[model samples]
Every structure is written in C-alpha cells, then in structure tokens.
Target: MLAMGEVHTGLLQNSGEISESTCRQVLGLMAGETVRVSRRPIPHALSPERLTGVDCALPSASRSRIRGVGTVVSRCAVTGGRVAQGSSYVRVVRSEADRRLPWSHYLSRPGVVEVLGKAKAADLAEGFVGDPAPGCLDMGAISGRFLDLVQASPLLDRRAPFRIPRTSLRWVAETGEPSIRFTLHTEQERTLRLTHPGPFTPAVVDLCEDLATHDWLLTSLLIIVERARIGATPGAQAVARLAPAIDHLLHLWMPAARVEEWLRPFWESLERQPGFTRQWRSLVDRVRDQIATSTLALLSAATEAGRR
Candidate 1:
C-alpha cells in the first residue's frame, strides 16, 4: 500500500503489483469509487529497521483504509531486519499479496486479534491510528460500556440466555457461562470452518472476568491518582500505583501495543510519584503478580467453557 508520509518523502516508488479483482474487493469494502495504492518490494523475509515499530500513513479515499494514520508493529532482531513468527503489524491490508506477506499473515494467527467486519476493523484502526482513549477517556468509555452490558445481562438466572442473537447485545449476552459467539454471521451461510480450534472457552471467560474487574481497577485508580496528586494518604497513593500495574498483568493476552500504550504510561507515572510507600509498592507488586496468574487462568476458563 501507498505510504502517506513516505510518498511525499521521495522514497523508493514502484508501479502496480495488485490484481484488479483484489483492488475491486478492497474498493467495495471501502465504499470508495476512486482509490490509489502504492507497491513496494517485498523480500521473502523482512528487513526490520533499528526501530521495532514505526508509524505509517497510507492515503485512501476513505478513513477506512490507512490514510495519514496507522502504526505497524513488528519483531526485529536488527533495526528493521527479520520478522519473527507471530510478528504481524497493523495496516490496511487489501490485496492477496498484502495478506500473503508475513507481517499481514501473522495478524490472523491465534492469540492475535482478528477484528472481523468493518465496524471492528474501524475500531482497531482508530485505536492504532487515531488518537486513542486520550488518557482516562478510553478507560471511562470501557468502564461505561462494560457496566452497561453487565447490567443488561440476566444475573446468572433465567437460563442466563443459552443463546443470544447477533445484535448489538451480542457481546453482553456472550458473558453467559459456556457461550460461543458463532463465527458465521447468521444470515450468510458459508461452507467454511476453522482448521484450528478457537481459543479455549475458559480463557475467554477468564478474560471476560479480568475485563470486568479492570473496569473497577482502572477507573477507580485514575480517580485516586487525580485526587492524590494534590497530596493524600500514603495508603491512597499506594493504592493508585497498584491499580494500573494489576491492569497490565490482567490484560496480558491483549495486543502488546494496546497494553503498552494504555497501561504502561500509568505504571510509569505511579513509579515516578513520591506517594508510594515501601509497603505500598510491595502490595501493588503482589496484586500485579496476581493479575498475571489470573490471565493464564482465564485461558483455562475460556477453554473449559468451550468444552461444556
């Protein structure tokens, strides 16, 4: 794809490498009549730059594809040399060649997020490319949505909805024990099946629990941090430090980019502050470890839930 920043930077330029059919598919998804793409040389392998990651802007008619926004993450032994397995980066991949490349191919691998559908893809693009969360706003939005969904669910009663329709309420209803959100949209009947097993159901449940719990931890922690910056109890300061760290530990399965961007800054902030007492740091570390343990347990839960 065309690199927005580099296109103007007078970088190595190439001609069309994408087939017409692929371009049509991409344009259809984009809902754009006219679209432009750039081609680049792709060795069988990659040459990682000194940076493990870089922000790339790809121009597109719509915001749907990369257009002056998007960041690519990769694993590099050197600056930009070899890409390790499971080292997929984010981009508006459209062509077969685009998807065939290792950086694009690995994104679909298990343990990585497969943001199905345009809506979810937009969210992913926004999170990666657009200004995300903007500090606590993202945290607040997550909390608000989670609580709304939880409140919407049947509280472990009323058969707890054995099955939920694929509507806006799909994600909320999915919290029920032993639930599987169907891969195929109910309307479209495709004769496809995943060659590999989906993530363990137990892990999904655990992740759900962790996410549910995180609403409280991060939202509350942010509140405490704001109040304490003006000076509060050593105890209060200690509590703030622990919240984001635990959030990190619990969110282990998430894309590292998201985790690093969201939680790491907060952890660093707490570390730099004078409020944490020795005992407080110890307590926070303990909770962080607990979150780590819980993350692994989550996978088991998701797996077990699938079995039942």
Candidate 2:
C-alpha cells in the first residue's frame, strides 16, 4: 500500500492572531461538524475532514497507463491563528475488479484509491515526486481550494501582515524498512519519500503537517531577509524591512513541536543534513543586529543635535 499527500501553507489573511471562536467560524467547512482544537504547545484548530471524488490516470515513471478511482480526503488547519494550511491525502490500493466502481462504493472508502491495473509503488512514488504529466491526480490543486476557502471567508479582514507566496510539499509513504527522505525542489516546492515499519496511520499525516509548517516558516524568513538587502540598504531601511519577520515569523521556528514521538527521528535526521534551525538562528541574529545598530544610530544623532 502507498499513501500520497500534499500540503499548502501560507499566512492567515487576518492582520493579527485570531481568537478560537473566530478560527472555528472561518474553518467551518462541513455542516454540523465540530472543528478539533488543541491548546497545548500552540492553539491549533482543524476543520472536519471532507472528501473529493477523483478518477484520473496515475502517473508512472515507466510511462505505463494506469488509472485510479476514489475519493481524496482534505482538511484545513489554523495554527496560532496566524498560519493556515490545507492538507490532502489518498491511499492507493489494488482493486479486485478492473472497472470503475459506483460513486457510493468509492465514497464508502474515503481517502482510499483503488488502482484498476498493474502498477508499482516505486514507479508511482517516483512519478509523483518527479514532474507529473497532465491529467494525473492533482492533490496540490485540491489542497489549494481548501486554503482558498479559509482565506476568502468574509469574517477575515483579508489583510495579511505580510505578502508572501505559499509553499507546497508533496509526500509519498510506503511500508518497508523505516526510512525517510526529504528533498527541496524549486523555490516553492518540496517532496518527501518515506518507508515505515508499521502500517500507515494518521500519525504519519500529523508528522507531514508539522514538517510542512516548519518548512514554511523557514522559507518565509529567508525571503524576508533577502528582501531586506542587509548590506546594500541603509541600516534603518533594512531594519524596517525586516521588522515583520520579528513580529510575525521569528517565534514560529519550533520544529517537531507537534510531531509524534515515533516520527521525531525523521525530523532530527532532516535537521542534521539541512541544518534548518542552524540557518534560522543565523538569520534571526542578523535581523536583531540590524535593529540594534539602527537604534544606536538614532540615539547618536539625537545626542549630537542636543550638543549643537
């Protein structure tokens, strides 16, 4: 069995962190369903899971023709009332019959897609992480729609504190010897391949969400620093450009904060190679130095004016 998912992360449209009640109202995607909330570590709220019907060709590395039919599961999450994420995933399994099933049959098994023909897990995984051709299952688009729903809510002011592009992470997991590999593709895209010893579970989904959240934080901060033009721009001007990072993005560098214990090792391994926190700390320090230097310059000018 193989599972694939994608997550889209971006800043909430609200100017400031929103309240729990507001989060619930914004993420109320399903009628009569309660949004799950967890207060510890951070204030997080999750919309009830919704399913979307999909019948499309499954991409294969070997270029073989394969089709899958089922429903894709999706949900929206709000973290600290500042960041929003839309996550979608579907499990791939072999079908006993080689033809399309009834919509009710597919709906009965939410989040599970049945492949109608021969296929290899490795090929599908490779094709998904690699460039996918047109007409293949598009989980990224599905995830984006859910995110749009929350961002378009009338309750929100539609004014984000900062203007930054969203980031997407595509991941595939299969049961095997325990292992994980995460790769950063182009600027706004990433992919992950994992092999777990136990059966696939929802905790794996949680792990992916945590990774995506931290990855987004890192990406947003890097963009902010680049925009500041630290050395070329004037000290005060650079500090002004980076002020949003300190206010909205700096404290969100908590990696594995919401990850399950069993999946913590995956995050630890990633840290060693990529050194996510190491780079984040360096950027944070640089921002702080710029601010301090600008303050000192202002003080010096004030003193000189008084003396004159």
Candidate 3:
C-alpha cells in the first residue's frame, strides 16, 4: 500500500494573525467535529478531516488505466493563526475484485482508495512525483480548494500583508528502509518520497505536513528577503520590506514540532543535506541585521539634527 498526499500552504488572508476563537471559526468545516488546537511551541489549529469521494485514474508512468475508488481525506490548518494550509491524501491499495464496487464500500473506508487492475507502486510514484498527466488523481487541487475555502471565509478580512503564492507539496510514502527524499521542482511545487520501516500510519502524514509547513516558511522568507533588496535599496526601505516577515513569519519556524519522536531522524537527515534550518536562520539573521542597521542610521540622523 502507498500513502500519497498533498499540502497547500500559504499566508492567512488577514493583516495580522487571528485569535484562537477566530481560528476555530475559520477552520470549522464539519458540524459536529471539533477543531483541535495546540498552544505550546506555537498556536496551531487543525480542522476535523473531511472525506471527498474520488473515482479517477491513478497516475501511472506508463499511462495505464488504473482506476481507483475511495474517499480522499482533507482538512484545513492554521499555524500561529497566520499561516493557513489545506491537506488532502488517500491511501492506495490493490482491490480483490477487478471492477468498481458500491459507493458505500468505499465510503466506509475513508481515505483509502482501491485500485482496480494491475498497477506498480513505483510507476504511480514516479508519475506523481514527476509531471503528472492530465486527469490523474489530483490531490493538489483538492488541497488547494480546501485552502481557498478557508481563505474565503468571512472571518478573515482578505487583507494579507504579502501576496505570495501558495506552495504545493506532493508526497508519497511506502514501507521500506526508512529514508526520505525531498525535491523542489519549482517555486510552488515540491515532492517528497518516504520509506518507513513499518506499516503506514497517520504519523507519516504528520511528518509530511510538518515538512510542508516549514518549507513554505522558508520559501516565503526567501521571497521577502529578495524583495527587500538589502544592498540595492536604502537600509530603512529594505527593512520596511522585511517588516511583514518579522511580524508574521519569523517566529513560526519550529520544525518537527508536530512530528513523532521516532520520525525525527528523517528531518535531521534533511537538515544535513539541503539544510532547511540553516538557510532559514541565515535569512532571519539578515533580516535582523538590516533592521538594526536601519535603526542605528535613523538614531544617528536624529542626534545630528538635534545637535545642529
């Protein structure tokens, strides 16, 4: 069995981070289900998972007609009440029968899709991680729509400080030798391939979401830093460009905050290679240095004016 999912991450369309109550109101998707909130390392809120039924062709490298039927799990999340994300995923498994089954059968097993006919896990994984052909199972779209739903909520003012595009992270996990591979295909597209030593679990999903959250943070910060034009523009002006990031993003970089303990090695391994935290800290330090220099310049000018 393979667990494939996508997460869409972006800024919450509000001038500032929303309050806990507001976060609840914005993420309240299902009627009876509760929105879970954690306030330790950061104020995070996650909506109850909602299932969407799908009967589509599984992405195949050889363009095979591997039709699958099941519900896809989706939910919206708010991190520090500033970053919003929509996640959707489905577990793919081969079915005993070779044809379509009743809707209720799929409905009963939420977030599990049964593929009809023969299909190789590697083929599907390759097709998905690479450029997927049109009309394949589109978890990215489902996740994006969920994000759009939250962004369009009346609770928000639709006044995001920065207008950065959302980042989409597609991931696939299978049981194997416990390794992780993260690839950035484009500014907005990323993919992760994971091999765990045991059976697939929700912890895998948590790890993916956590990585997606941090990756989006790093991407957004880089954009902000470039826009600051540190040396090209006046120090004060550059600092002004970075103000929104300091206000809304810098403090939200607690990696693996939600990941299970045993799975932390995966994050640590990535840290050694691409060095997500290393780059993030460098950006943070640059932002701070710019702010400090600008402040000093302003202070010196004020003192000189008073003396004159």
lDDT of 3 by residue, 14-64 (tens): 988999999998999988889999998888999999999999998888888
Candidates, ranked, TM-score: 3, 2, 1
Off by over 4 Å in 1: 1-129, 132-147, 154-219, 222-308
- Which candidate, 2 or 3, would have the higher lDDT against the true structure? 3
Once superposed on the true structure, which residue ranges of model 2 sit more than 4 Å away at CA? Answer: none
How high a TM-score does candidate 2 get? 0.96
Residue pairs in clash, model 3: none
- Among all candidates shown, the one with the greatest lDDT: 3
TM-score of each: 0.20, 0.96, 0.98
Full ranking by lDDT: 3, 2, 1
All candidates' lDDT scores?
0.27, 0.90, 0.93
Angstrom error of the Cα, residue 126, model 2: value is 0.4
> Cα miss at 1, model 1 (Å)?
11
Best of the two (2, 3) by TM-score? 3
Model 1 C-alpha lDDT per residue in residues 1-308, reported as the tens digit of each score: 11100000000111212243333332231233333332222111112211122223322224343322223332111000111111122223334322223544443432222222232333432243233333211222222232233223232122211121111111111111232222222231101111113322322322222222222223333343444342234443444554543433223212212122322433233235422233344444555554465566678889999999
Q: Give one digit per residue, the lDDT tens place, for model 2 in 167-245.
A: 9999999998888888998999999898887888888888898889988988999999999999998988899899988
